[model samples]
Target: MELQPLATFRVELAPVLHVGRTRWGDRRVIGIVGGSFSGPRLNGEVLPGGADWQVVHEDGSASIDTRYTLRTHDGALLYIQTQGVRHGPPEVMARLAAGEDVDPAEYYFRLFIRFETGSPDYAWLGRTLAVGTGRREPNAVVYDAFTLT
Candidate 1:
């Protein structure tokens, strides 16, 4: 199968709310403030009230699970859920966890994305498998999402 570009979007984040370690290791939540996206067939604004729930393991790798929403320019709403992992050298991971701006290429961040929407115009999203490659910024994340074809 090949991958086709679906959309590229930026997720602006609020500060991380550290929930500390539990049975699952270190836990934290990052809030999604606002952002925008555009592509040939999909264009929208990422609505607020979304959050990334993260767990950091002893190896310094992190498991990322995020739930969010997107409102297309035309008013259609898409619910998005992504599961992924982020890992790298200890120093690089430390820098990222500290909210520092490190080159995304220095580490690995990828996600499996799923979309659900009631709008006929976007119904295709629910039937396809998608993936995303992401980069971490100081206060936001940028990702390019692609559908498997």
Candidate 2:
């Protein structure tokens, strides 16, 4: 016998709100707006590939601008509206604002995005977004970075 692949994917819809405090005096929280849809489109077309994420403040402020792209050409995509908050107030962002030295790790972070397929429904992949450890340059104007896979 041989194993077959999935044709479609679906995740139950539900609004989510989560929060947690880090060991280094940092606190994080998030609110999932809604489910997203991604299908075959263009390079910047966040579907049939991936999407973007923005880490914002509690008072409706936006942080670093993080984006996700498709590395492979498969019938896969991601879509969702999410907002987050970070506490403890690191100085890296402040330093970058002032003209001083700041380490990326000083404001490290992470996010887990799991993709699930139908029938034998299971997570196809999981992407984690961590500070300092990424491919592109980190945004200082905002609070933190994001990841997707």
Candidate 3:
């Protein structure tokens, strides 16, 4: 299979709200305030009210689940759900949490991105399998998603 560039999106996040440890793990939620995306075929802005629900394991690895809505410039709404993992050395993760400018290559942040939309203009997204590579910025997380063909 070949991977084609689908879209690249930059997600602006609010400060993470810690939920502390539960029976499952250490839970946290990052509010999705706003963001935008631009790509060859799709361009839009991410609406508010979405969130990333995270579970931090004992080993410092985080399992990520994010659900959000994307409104295309042309007025189509797409539902986005991405499941991913982010992990690295403790020091590296600490630097990220401190909002330091560390190299993304030093850590592993990847996701399986999925989309659902009833809009005819974006129906292809509903059938594609996409993967994303992520990097943590000071106030946002950026990711480039590619579709598998």
What would the per-residue lDDT of candidate 1 be over residues 46-126, giving only the tens digit for each residue? 999889999999999989899999999999999999999999999998998788999989999999999999999999999
Each model's TM-score, in the order given?
A: 0.97, 0.30, 0.97
lDDT of 3 by residue, 17-37 (tens): 999999879999999989999
- Best-to-worst lDDT order: 1, 3, 2
Off by over 4 Å in 3: none
Clash pairs of candidate 1? none
- lDDT, candidate 1, residue 79? 98
Candidate 1 stretches with Cα past 4 Å from truth are none
9-71 per-residue lDDT for model 2 (tens digits) = 121211212233333322322222222222222111222322233443543223433333322
What 10-residue stretch in candidate 3 is worst by lDDT? 40-49
> Whose TM-score is higher: candidate 2's or candidate 3's?
3
